[model samples]
Target: MPCDLEMGLDNNEDGNGSPETKKIGGVEEEDGDESVGLSRKMSEASICAAEDDEDEEGRKIELGPQCTLKEQLEKDKDDESLRRWKEQLLGSVDIAAVGETLEPEVKILSLAIRTPGRPDIVLQVPESGNPKGLWFTLKEGSRYSLIFTFQVSNNIVAGLKYANTVWKTGVKVDSSKEMLGTFSPQEEPYTHEMPEDTTPSGIFARGSYSARTKFVDDDDKCYLEINYTFDIRKDWQSS
Candidate 1:
């Protein structure tokens, strides 16, 4: 792969009529190119890993100082201008109703499955140790989506995230993570739907898949975790 001979650039001589490397502004030597290339690749990999860790360690990110919404709203009530601005920012959310709790409380009430041109199949979220198991089936190559209805109370939930991992026969097939942004306690539950995806179309891909999903905030406080199983079949499963 060395193109020095092809480009007629094999002249590894110095300016003093002695043997030296071509400087090309002296950024690096010809012999160090391989090392530089390897270092660049390693740096890129490190960046990718750091990005992944960033979601898990989001609470540690500094944003000056942190305070509850109640505290922030009460911080500077004397200044009418500032108070109005804060009111505009918080909107009609009643901070006084969030109570005196110090940490956020989140509840995922339901999970719904939606297929194009079909009614949504709403499923109740099961308890952690419920003796019963939750299951569903999807047709191969059929597009479907998942929706979560959740509520945040007590305080603001920062960097809310949803993570799901799928496995088939004990081997992980896919993993997905998404930041659901921050949420303040409100009277209404929040509904978020993930992008739709098609079931893989193949005999090997059609099988039972177990998935574990978790909802957590920046503090790593898990709001909910669910383990469920589903099947990808050749045809839509009848109710």
Candidate 2:
């Protein structure tokens, strides 16, 4: 039987904005009247300094707008909110289940890469006798497509429910998530393109980059995830 390959690319933007700011680290800011008074005081101090002699330390201190303190407080709140959101998003996996040894119901049959105007390139893993590792060089500023195929075992009705791809190099690049409909015995091949127009453009660092794929069952109860690490470079080398 021919193996089924599934691929999908989602660039849809969803609302994951920062949470509302009401308090920070269990402490609320002063009331509106007090805050306004403090701001006015700061403004008055700045004006007074402008007309007075320089500081005794022999250097003049420049004060920004009166709202600087407020802006900084809001920024701190935003950073904390983002940190909590990331923790919740990536820490949903069960720790106890990590020790279980269970074969995946759905297996990755193959992973292939293709660049626009270029031939398709199939990657080989250790199981296929390529022990060194499966890797390919991706040129900067060029769009590449990835195709994923999966083999569904008997009695398994898994499907590609949610899919996302992220690029991490010290920090995360913008990514998209999609909710694909369920599939029965077998799922179709999925394809996705990287560096979509909306994606930020720049020279990606030349090193290992991780590509993660996840497949969930019809009920969204069980899932299988696979990660592929490959290299990207400015130019391809002949072996």
- The best candidate by TM-score is 1
lDDT against the true structure, per candidate, is 0.57, 0.38
Highest lDDT model number = 1
- lDDT by residue (102-176, candidate 1, tens digit) is 677889888888889888878787677121443777777777777888887776665576766777799867665
> Which residue window of length 10 is worst by lDDT in model 2?
1-10
Which parts of model 2 are misplaced by more than 4 Å? 1-10, 13-104, 125-134, 155-159, 165-167, 186-201, 204-207, 221-223
Model 1, residue 88: distance off in Å is: 4.2
Instruction: List, residue by residue over 103-154, the lDDT tens digit for candidate 2.
Output: 2245556666666677767764334323244356565545555555654432
- List TM-scores for all candidates, in order: 0.69, 0.42
Candidate 2 achieves a global lDDT of 0.38
